[model samples]
Target: MTAFDGIGGAYAENLPVIMISGSPNTNDAGAFHLLHHTLGTHDFKYQIEMARKVTCAAVAIDRASDAPRLIDHAIRSALLASKPAYIEIPTNLAAAPCAPPGPISAVLAPERSDPDSLAAAIDVAVSFLGKKLKPMLLAGSKLRAAKAEKAFLELAEATGYAVAVMPGSKSFFPEQHPQYIGVYWGDVSTKAANNLVDWSDGLLCAGTVFTDYSTVGWTADPKGARIFTADMDHISVTGHDFSRVLLADFLSGLAQKIKYNDATMVEYSRFRPNPTLQPAAEPEAALRRGEVARQVQSTLTPNSTLFVETGDSWFNGVQMDLPDGARFEIEMQWGHIGWSVPSCFGYAVGAPNRKTIVMVGDGSFQVTVQEVSQMVRLHLPILIILMNNHGYTIEVEIHDGAYNNIKNWDYAALIETFNAGEGHGKGYRANNGRELADAIAKAAANTRGPTLIECTLDRDDCSKELMSWGHWVGAANARPAAAI
Candidate 1:
């Protein structure tokens, strides 16, 4: 049940995943025997039915004759749509005789754009790109879903336009590239990057979704500005919508026609004459969010995967620079509080060679803290940076309530119980910058299993972006009903 929402999130983030689970016995569908896993009922179809709301395909393998077709169809649908698919196997079907399985080679062939639509989208985009002040390019999360991040990068390089990635699309383009600007998340965007992008006469947004979350509570103005958007299956230009013009095809086509221009980058350099880095808090000073971030930033190595939990962690983690070959994972689309704890474990399990770093708030940490024991049992060397603030700070920023508070936990000490003298998991408390640095060093040294460093934080401490975002989002949510 918990996995359902996260799987649904993949669809909104424009990613693909396959979820498989077993349903109740189908033979006694109407016999209400109050099965243990059936939510106090005998309905065997609720699992598939609920999945249907979020997955591109949801199917059951009831008969051996239907297994191969149903499974193949579910996979193909998921891949083609870049969304999740669910497969349910009944308990009775587990031991049923079935034919030998064959290889599953469902191919997602490159889809071509409609010729006329492609030509028009390219022409419309070049009108913006070919300007004396070349338009800026804003890459969105869908670039990965469309499998067009490479194409998007090629387009940026060929056109010489400055590129800024959406917060959700972190690390899609090499952040170290000369043509790259910082994130373009409206008011939360880096000042120089925000100015450069906003001042442009025209902008081309590729594979972007402009929900309230992405727009920072409808305060972002990309769509309101002079811009054209290219999505997975269509391109919308000024007063024109071109359907069936796939994002990848449009990028390839536009790259062939657009002229090179570096005006945007030139302006960016002048606006951000000297990149600023505030000095870290004195080593013995109490740990603030930014100071903890600074310490974690120092620990990022090449090819490490970062898992940022929802809440203020989103704001902090997104600001960190990911080394080349590093990846960023966040469940921002769903905004599920506890998504990171287990997701980090899963990522570490799948890519054992890469270090997995997770930053989570105290409230969210408690939601799925049990996953830490599994990581210890598997002896996975993952780093968990926990902010022990005693309550849900993000919620308080948005809408304060009694429910926002949570009992404080001794998070660092709790990890020792998981370690149980046999496991290699290590836990430490960091009350200051020096303690944080020391804990990280020890985590790096402990190569056998996971490590938890619970950094103490003031109850009200949070990123400025979160406060600003929460203010706007709260206003939007509280807006009174419009007169019909």
Candidate 2:
């Protein structure tokens, strides 16, 4: 028997995967009837039984005529459970005729969130909103997938709430909007953003998977604070009952139902970010890489897309100023180290016409470096900025004494290694601000394939603000009971 661990164990939380397997039919005379060592033993029910442990639902279909209904039930189970499911198809039935398409009937599941529970949650949320001087909204990816962006924006605008988007959900709400705060997660997140989470009287999560990475390991507060969550599955809250579970579809509809008033809008405007955060500094040679990233922001056309990898490069990548229609993507859920390359491949494929750029650190670049071949083969007009600091800089901050170091790579040479020749694509190296600017300009001009800019910077150069914020947050988390 073959065991399949669906993608949901760690990687895919909300995604549904259906696994189908083939088994030899017992009715066939030529099939061996061996119970222990031979093929098709134990009636093939054990495979389905084993699959049941990992899957939300499982079934075995022996007859050819029942294949359609069995497959339909498996799919329905997956959607309803919002998790992985499986089905075992007999080898003999594999070649059988499938039933004609039937009238599609929507599977109606019971209301996940009770009306009274929703009312109670709304009451608690409203009470907290009335009391708090400054409250904020932390929007997640599920909300974007459910198409609740507009409604979420309206809610934020109506309630005098500042918005802090999670890394994966960056650009869900326009980054340039006055009410928008920066991305949260990792050491790069702003101190003010973490403060907003800690001090807020109410923390409302809509369509967000409240995982450890997103909440920074529950370091943010939840107790006594009003918490209202809307998700397709039943998520346990400290004080709430199971009745608080909400269907993703219904939550979106409810968001649209609420009306916004002018007075509410005026109140929301009060929380808009102060303009002092934006600063101008001379482009120092040591800070050339980060400065170039900021400069690239200005070159972006409307609706340009940016994808950032995890590591030192992310430190500067998040600081890039974006235009109104620009979008940014980062892996906040898994925090997988080498995701930028493949993720950029996926993004470029999905949005072919849009300008896509990936920012990666030297250490992260090597993990999935081969993805450059994919970009070259497809002729994607993507730009890659390699921040070659020679090692893992973020790890150094996390554990000051530990050696989480890495060997260096001649990053620009990888373009040729991947077979992207001069006419197809070119690689450039930058050691200072002027060279970095020239490299970026050349990349912007190249419309054929991807370009890689390897920027050499001193290892000592790091984001001081980020380091300070990390220390403050860590110390706050370690404070004594009296401090709380």
Q: What is the C-alpha local distance difference test score of each model?
A: 0.85, 0.64
Q: Which numbered prediction scores highest in lDDT against the true structure?
A: 1
Candidate 1 root-mean-square deviation in Å: 2.1
Query: For model 1, how many clashes?
Result: 0
CA displacement after TM-score superposition, residue 212 of candidate 1 (Å):
1.7
Any idea how many clashes model 2 has?
1
- Model 1, C-alpha of 105: deviation from truth (Å): 3.9
lDDT of 1 by residue, 299-395 (tens): 8878788888989998988888778888888776778898899889988988999989999999999888899999999999999999988899889
Q: Pick the candidate with the highest TM-score.
A: 1
Which portions of model 1 miss their true places by more than 4 Å? 30-34, 39-42, 98-103, 107-116
* Candidate 1 C-alpha error for residue 131, in Å: 5.1
